[model samples]
Target: MNRTVVRTEDLWKVYPQEPKPVEAVRGVSLEIQAGEFVAMAGPSGSGKTTVLNLLGGLTRPTRGRIWIGEDEITALSDRELARLRLESIGFVFQAFNLLPVLTALENAEFTLLLRGVPAEERHRRVRELFALIGLDGLEDRKPGKLSGGQQQRVAVARAVIGEPALVLADEPTANLDTATGAALLEVMERLNHENGVTFLFSTHDPRVMERAHRLIHLVDGSVESDVAQGVRGGVGHDR
Candidate 1:
């Protein structure tokens, strides 16, 4: 059975400065179980990215604790946190962030390479991931050659190629058209259902919230509401 993948206790993020600090996340607490798809929705500069950074181990909280399973990530060294992120978390950013020189397969293969997976296994995994994300025919295409949706598909393939327990997506559909964005989200939803991977995304789009199984709304750096799928009125389906 899948386990609870994330737990945040009174999480707080404050950007330090000479005078008053900017508080981004203020005493927020959350728990995400395996196979759950949760969305963090808020206006711009409302601590959504800060929350994502904290969850992905990219930024340590100024106060409180973040635990990925039993690991207290906020207490780890930078190197340790980096290693843990590499091994346990997959990230999808607003920008595709694919290397312009690498093909889709090569981009996906990069994640496996970082994990010390052998070339043969990496190749196998990359091909399988590409096929899973509907990027099979475009494996050899560079980011410049692929459409925005196709490139985002490659990014998703790269992010989940290793099947990490947690996937953090920050405004994943920000760059795509309506139809393409919906398709990309469907791919993510399918992945969560079929693979039991937990997804914690920071998004402000109605489309993103529409598909989420839960929406945690943030305002002024604190959680204003936590609504489950189907409990609130929305435009999308959650299964």
Candidate 2:
């Protein structure tokens, strides 16, 4: 079997509300292997976001166990959880959360800076990544000056800069045009395939579901199906 990088057993998340408790996620059990590109497909309020948040260590589960590698996330202190997130998880949000005052290159290098990578090395790696994403000449531009697609590319670069083992993309392409979004997915796919970066995406995008090697269909806070898409180990679904 492939090495399991993330595992969740009987996971549950409940939020207190005025009328009643909101059960956001219900008894989710999943194991994500190293380098696998998995997609979680569901409509709004279907627990997709909850699953992503749990996986990213954004919030502790109300019940059950979450493991990253062999470490149990639910057992860790908050500081330890934060450290784990810094070292092992890379997040790409739909908002493209680039620092407004930073240039594209600076945004991409932010994570590396936090990691204490020397400035010269960070610049070198940023150049290579910018070229990889076809944003070579736009490195000096800030997020506001770049197109939505460009900003998203910068976000991807930032996420990958740390070389985190797992990347959690939450509606990563929701803001882009069709062509741009497809290109962005291709870039992410290449990283997952060639660099062995595992990806777990929370998406309603048919394109994402189609391209993903594994489809995890969620409905009403429960898993409806967890199927291998195409041939065993191949991308099987498309819009």
Candidate 3:
């Protein structure tokens, strides 16, 4: 049986506002198993990002609990959460947060560097992913020298280099052109199939939704629908 990499129970996030509180996530429960390519899809203010953030330990929930692998996130301290993220979770955001001063290879290996990976093994692992994520020859180039797509590829490579149990991506394809987005999707797809890495994305892009094995549709802070992949004539829900 595949391990459950992420589990959330009755999660909620309420932002305090004048006269009223905004409920970003309301009573959400979810389970994501190993190797699943899942997308959290919803319109704006629907809590897709909130759910992802809770899962990734980026934000504390207003109420309820989350488990990433064996760690119960709600019970952890801030420092513990930081350590957990460094060791077990990876993040890819819309902005492709690569350091301007770092080379593609350096940016890709940044997390590993934080963990004190030695030079030879770090180069080996990052170099291997450059090919997998399609950033091969550009390893020596800095972020400013790369195209938007290439920068995102470097980000993706960085996220998975340590083989984290879960990768959370928010609007991953949001800043790319059509062709570039598709190429990036293809790279992610290959990694999930071949490497058994779990991916969870929060996105509204139909292209990203279409490529996912499961679509978790959130509306007004709750699940509107949970859809298996129907595009390929195969059922792919929560498998």
Pairs with backbone N, CA or C atoms under 3 Å apart (clashes), candidate 2: 210-237, 210-238, 230-236
| Global fold similarity of model 3 (TM-score) | 0.95
Taking all chains together, each candidate's TM-score versus the true structure is: 0.92, 0.94, 0.95
Q: Over the stretch 88-120, how does candidate 2's per-residue lDDT look in tens digits?
A: 888899989999999999999988898789999
The TM-score, computed over Cα atoms with residue i paired to residue i, of candidate 2 is 0.94
Error (Å) of candidate 3 at residue 131 is: 1.5
**Residues 56-146, model 3: lDDT tens digits:** 7889999999999889999999999988998999889899999999999999898899899999999999988897787889989999999
Measured on C-alpha atoms, candidate 2 has an lDDT of 0.88
List all candidate RMSDs to the true structure: 3.7, 2.7, 2.5
Stretches > 4 Å off in candidate 2? 231-239
Each candidate's lDDT (Cα)?
A: 0.85, 0.88, 0.88
Q: Candidate 3: lDDT of 42?
A: 89
Cα lDDT of model 1 overall? 0.85
